[model samples]
Target: MITEDQLTSQEAIALEEKHGAHNYHPLPVVLSRGEGVFVWDVEGKKYYDFLSAYSAVNQGHCHPAIVDAMNKQAQTLTLTSRAFHNDILGRYEAFATDYFKFDKLLPMNTGAEAVETAIKIARKWAYEKKGVKEQDAQIIVCENNFHGRTTTIISFSNDEGARKNFGPYTPGFIKIPYDDPKALERALIENKNVAGFLVEPIQGEAGVYTPSDDFMKQAKAICEKHNVLFIADEIQTGIARTGALLAVCGNCTCEGHCERQETYSRPDILILGKALSGGAYPVSAVLADDEIMNVIQPGQHGSTFGGNPVAGAVAMAALNVVKDENLAQNARKLGELFRAKLNEYIKDSTIVNLVRGRGLLNAIVINDTEDSSTAWDICVALKENGLLAKPTHGNIIRFAPPLVMNEEQLLDCVAIITKTLGDFEK
Candidate 1:
């Protein structure tokens, strides 16, 4: 074993800086190991992981069951490249489809790839099934949505930073106001070539901005009436992260009562990623019924690593963790506790404006300009206090710890957050 003094956090960070690309602006701490809701740096300093790797660690980091499955599959078979049948892929497809209540599953490698696949399917369905003219099919998307980073995906993005140099973007996408059902209806009614409405159930990357109550259901209804597909991007909020197996499963109502009622909101096309492999492997998938998914005739859509044995096994175990441990209920319970505690702190503090989220996928709005450093400064202090979290947009900090975190651990974090925020003087 490496000695603590010899393997310091700073030394590890320096090594990364020397060799790795500067794509992410991570905290100055270097993570070496993780389990449950906690992670340790190379120097053996432990900290509560509040961001959950952008909610990808919902099943906790390096879950033993998921890891074991990956190891077993690795020793047996890793990839068959979808050329020949793999033992685990079909089983995983059935398992995932049944779990999400979909008829078919299109496995992919990353969240972006899943999003891209859904777009292709929606367009093809529009043309083949809905009789929309080729090259004229249009899909409706929300403003400020973080679908992915591909050229086509970024084309419709409202953020200049994401689109500045990437332009001449792919067309055929219609932009609409988020959280407004009326806007969606108007667009669908006005556009004869409307194909589908693609949106995030809860926009995680856009500072965890959840929409109005009845937004999703109403959107689904409109899509049905207009013969349009309602595609949900649940990459960040799916798999029990939002307290109910899926964020769309719970009522979109802002009222607290909806959490009690077991409502299963279904989307025509469901995209999932991030925690699909319990942070053990890169796995993503899009689930849909047969009619819609059948639009793609093989060779049009496939990935070399989409349904490999390793991915299949890891995904199964990761999903089992969610179902077996009742992570949905745990997240729901902890979310309530978290929001209640944060609301109490929000009463008088000028630094924190408000807290809003469905389950553990929540964010706190800092009362400052969009470019303000208050959120970043607070995060630095939180790191000093032994909790690791980061700001999303300039002034918003998302707090999503792993679902395996217990009440005692959560309270300790709450205390740390309250103290850290309390010390910041306006």
Candidate 2:
């Protein structure tokens, strides 16, 4: 019966260990508060948040504008299940569709749900519009992609850890090597039943494996030639996390005004989550033009809280912050500075191999074997030194701070990161 305020960090950890599901292996720090680019441990020590909740808080923690919108909507009207009409859904739908230059959007609660919705849409479009036989339509996915842990998503995932005991898996998916346009082209040409090609513009979960600049553009071209839907899962890499509004925008620095860039690759179906609500609420969406989105009718796919009033209000405010503050531009500028600073330090370093990523979403590979605990130990040291980041794929440490972080804060974080890595150097 101990109150939350009275519990120590160890006590809180112990409580979660006993009561919570043992799915996530979190860092030992027990955080109690956050603001902007920083979070505080229960003991009151402050640390820079480099992970940004897997790029969810790209606008930063407790972003005032997003939080204000969520709070106001929560006080006024929270949820009016899809069974009935709400006051804010239509306005949000219109605003979002225009913002992203899509003809329509289907709201959902989480990244996995949005991905599933997009899959369903693609399949339906194939059956009804593309003349593919029902249930015979196949979606193409890339290796090392991490869309989500949902049953349908994991069915196509090559990550044995996620798929190990979770079968009989969902079929109708073909896996191809990532970043290889030739492989993609071959897959599409070899399979006429392919309905869509689902890919992460930059593979964020597989240690921020950013592809070549023209990869997305080429993939979209190939999909277009084959009449396949090019679905971009920007759950972790979108919303200015990769310097652009969406990773599929390539190197365009037009911020959120994608119309100014002709080189950007527009996906047939774009799945977005994480930063969509600026971490204030769970709001994910699947956006496509009417030709592709019209496949689904009422009761075909939806969540009770999918397009709730609070989600609509919070998403609009969150998106407004991205454009008004020029977060995409900031991420682009800071990301260059971060990689430059790290590269300078890495020239003489032995324990660090290389840094790869776009914009604020970057990762450094430890020079040790993947099975080595070197990266994890370095992260533990980083925590003690007042910065927070996590290791991915064992030896790769992913660093994604909020886009709102200032140059001064980023330089300070870089210093901490280099100093921490220096300790583990051979």
Top candidate on TM-score is: 2
Task: Evaluate all candidate structures by whole-model CA lDDT and list the values in order.
Answer: 0.88, 0.93
Model 2 has an lDDT value of: 0.93
| Winner by lDDT | 2
TM-score of 1: 0.95
Clashing pairs in 1: none
For each candidate, give its TM-score against the true structure. Answer: 0.95, 0.98
Tens-digit lDDT string for candidate 2 (267-292): 99999999999998999999999999
Q: Which ten residues in a row have the lowest lDDT in candidate 1?
A: 251-260
Tell me how far the alpha carbon of residue 162 in candidate 2 is from the true structure, in angstroms, after superposition. 0.4
lDDT of 2 at 267: 93
> Residue 403 of model 1: what lDDT?
89
lDDT of 1 at 414: 98
Model 1 misplaced regions, further than 4 Å: 1-7, 251-263
Q: State each candidate's clash count.
A: 0, 0
